[model samples]
Target: MENLFFNHGKDKLLWETEDKILLAISGGVDSMVLLRLMEKLALKETIFLVVAHVNHKLRQESDEEEAYLRAYCKRKGIPFYSIQWQQATSFGMEEAARNFRYNFFQEVMEQTACNKLMTAHHGDDQAETLIMKLARGGSLNSHIGIQVRQPFSNGELIRPLLQFSKEDIRKWAAEQSLVFFEDQTNEDTHVQRNRIRKWVVPELKKENARLLAHAQQFSQQLEWAEALISEQMEKEFQTHVKKQAESWQIEGDWLMALPENQQYFFLSYFFKKSLSELQVGAKEEQLLQLLRLLKKEKAQWQVAFSNEWFFKKSYQQFSLEKNKQVTDEHHVLHYDEGVYLNDREWIGILKNVELDKVPAELEQIGWSTFRQDFPKDLAKEFFLRRRRDGERLHLTKNLTKKVSRYFIDNKVMNAKRATAWVLTDSKNNIYGLLPFTLSYLSIMEETDKIHYVLLYKYRE
Candidate 1:
């Protein structure tokens, strides 16, 4: 035990002599052995140790386990903390417990000013994880299973006992006359992981006695492959993905031009960003379908995920945005200066300025300069709304043109047209396009009495 601690714990600088460490103890043999080892280390090094245990209250012995561990820590003169699960749910109990445990560990570590968090995931856990990954057809990233060390929330998570087998930990605990509590639910074959740990791993060990070692070797190989692939994917992401103000934009054509594996990684990179636990294997088809859509010209589509995340492909540029609560509905409001159109995502204000003073930049798409004519009845009946189909606007005194044809001729993408808003009156006389243009009634000469109605468009 000392050799292992010195070689891996001390030599690797997993924790400094003066550093405070937090251990996640569950009153199991593995965690108990880890606690004992940490105690031995603390005797030689001036380090602080804090123990945290979570009581899920699922078993009758949960309270007993917590009491025993707390008493042990009390006798050892170490600080111990325990939290009970308040909310209970029958479905997804394993996942829920894991999330609750980790969140508690994070909170405790923060409160104690601990620099490192220690866990007791040993060789058996790694073997079971690998087996599950293989069964689920996991990607190269999943092949790494549980790492010895990783970055936790604002600190480091160190699994020092990963190199030790479950049997080895139990044997060491017995040799040292250490006491620990066992949760009998571990023997419940109803749980998939318990079944795998008891039967699948033991059966595999028959073929190779050192199955854990072989699995570690395979993981190392996968790690090497992933390192190379990850470097290339990062470069591709930097080159193609761009961060917009309220969304992320990716160059669709450039992304699709890469190799299929690189493309998968490129999409997976963003997927893992928003959906951290998303399994790429299950959603690969959806990604492929999106890629296919991107290849088509004028393709405008969106896929909504949890937490309001949406992937929108507009022509050759793809954007990932969080969908706002505001829907794309036609909103009609009485004409009032400085009115904000929440549904249209724009602010309407009538600014009084010289007609010739309008910036030439305002002529660009998504910005417009309109001159408002104050007819006594027009001002009273005027309203703001989203553009409607078959609406016509007069380009000349005698010539009227359909607004839809105007959009088509102007080469506006269908995606943008769908959510486009316009300003008009109750009599259906269009005064201005929300973000595109000003009608002839509004576009004036230098001497025209300019209400100078303008819309400042903003992303929702």
Candidate 2:
């Protein structure tokens, strides 16, 4: 037990003498054994021990279990917390109960000023979780099993007993003569976890005598693999992605250029960063489809997620944001040979052009003609920025329309409209092209007139 504690609980130890711990006890054998071990080690003298139990009130014995835990804590001279789940929900009963239980545990942790919340998830539980997640079809992240330490909101959740198997816990409890409650609901085969615990695990253990040990080892290896992948993914993200106040973006071509595994890994990482959880079931498959579609160059595209998150691809940039009213954010850039906009993503290129000597290939290269007699003065006042409301472009002298109306008329998506660019003179006139309108400032007629043509390209 000491070896397992030192090996698995090193990160959970806040301090030598003043650490406060909140134990989530269910009056079950595993938690009872954990309590006995802590008592034997005299941890209560060095650190404050608080036991918390949540009664779902689903079973008739739940109240009795809570009472038993309370009595035990009182005898040990430790604080005990109990909360009842009085609300009713129709679906996902187990998930709802687990969420409520952890929430109440977190509340107790906060109220008592505890640094860590401990659980009794042992090796069997870890194996069962991995199997369930695999059956539910999750990525490698789901295969990581139960984490020994994970960030819970602001504090940490530590499960030190995960290194020990269920048999080990039971033996410890028996040696200490510990009394624990048995929830009869655990025997109901209708529950998937109970079915797995009663039938699947026992059969597997018969085949491999040390199945629990193998499962624990596999879980640790998966966790290490996840850590390594995350480290590499962070490096890639730092090199190619940028997080803004209202949105997150990645350079399209750079992201697409990576290997397929890295692409999936980074996209999964981004999804978690944005939504705080992995997209599961059919939604995860849809997200993968969206990621594939984003690799292509589409004029206007958008994908919506279940949690009010939106994905948009415009030109050569991919962006993700929460569903909210997005206001225009303006960024200014001067005209030069190559000027970057929006954190060096979109680039503006300027070159001297003579109307007579303009190459026909220039049109093929996406160069928009910006003919002006005072080319140098226009260049000095030229700046590229995001579109604003009430802005209009002169499509022709007689054809003028608001930019917002233009988007509406052309079926431009709201996601694309947020980051679309508009070129204007110092007076804020619209010289729109492409995502912006196709109208030029003016036509070129004079052969001797010196002009400057500007075009935009996404930097890879």
Candidate 3:
């Protein structure tokens, strides 16, 4: 057991004499055995070891466990850091405790300048995790179970005991006569992991005595397969996906053109990359629904990806972004002044101005400036607002066209059609479509009276 632990640190982890490791000890047998193994390694290599413990304060024995571990660390002349989780939630106690524990470990690592944080997750834990994930169902990546090493905080989280089983650690602890705290809560069958550990694992071991070894092998194999898939997925992602400030954009046509399985893989990869911290990925039902949405005749649609995020398809582009409420706001604007239509768009009117006399700022290449003459007698107070459904623009005294039909006929993108402002008078007369087109009535020349030159600008 000592040899396996030592070689994993030396060969797999590439541990050097100067390397500092922060060990997350839970006062359980598994972590106690890991602490002993690390102690032995340190004696021979002069490596620095720091012990970090989280007193979850969930059970009556929590204080006793913390005291026991702290005394042991002091006796061993090792640095120890501990924190109490005082803000435990009533619900999701397990997940909350785990998060709190790791956060404390990260803090300890930073304080000690440690480059590696070691945990005591063993093969049995790995098997249980694999079974739980398989039963719950998630992306293929989740099936890989607990990794041997993964990036955490500023360094790496190394699980050296993954190659060892629970029995192996218990056996070593007995031989060494190591003292550790036993949390009686682990025996509660109501807990899913405890249930699996007590019943399912033994049953699996009955079928194959080397169940832990098999589970570890399966995890390694899945990791290798996922690594290969990720390599290709990255290449495809780089080629097709675009990262905007607050969202990720993908070419809908390119995604739909791929084989169905590839499409699923691509989306899974995309979600994993975008929400890596959340550990949320696209499930089969969600992916199938998204595929159906993508293939539909509608040019634009959106669905909730999760509580905090959404999947939006606009024309040929698909985007993943946070949930945002689309507001139908009206802005009353004055001449020579601009109002922000949106975060990235500004709209204003320039009255009585010729094309050649347009302000230099408005003459920038990207500004979508338009010029049109509105009747001098029209209401001075013009409002900018989103196009109303079935709204029409009077082109002339006898010709009027539906604004929606005009947008369709002009091949206006769904995004622009949704956000474009309709310039209307106080009487709800549509005179112009902001930067796109002006109604024919707006272009009609009044020979005997003056007209207002309405200039619109839309910056990116």
TM-score of each: 0.74, 0.68, 0.84
Residues 290-373, candidate 2: write the lDDT tens digits.
Answer: 767855666657777756667777656678766665455554545445444434244443446433343344445444343332
Pitting candidate 1 against candidate 2, the one with the higher lDDT is: 1
Question: Backbone clashes per model, in order?
Answer: 0, 0, 0
**Candidate 1: where are CA atoms >4 Å away?**
86-88, 134-144, 218-239, 274-285, 295-298, 306-308, 322-384, 390-410, 419-460
- Candidate 3 lDDT by residue in tens digits, 124-194: 99999999988898677778989888898888998889888888899999999999888898999989999
Ranking of candidates on lDDT, top first: 3, 1, 2
Query: Between candidates 2 and 3, which one is better according to lDDT?
Result: 3
lDDT values of the candidates? 0.74, 0.71, 0.82
Question: Which candidate leads in lDDT?
Answer: 3
Candidate 1 structure lDDT: 0.74
- Which ten contiguous residues of candidate 3 have the minimum total lDDT? 350-359
Candidate 3 backbone collisions, by pair = none
- Highest-scoring model, TM-score: 3
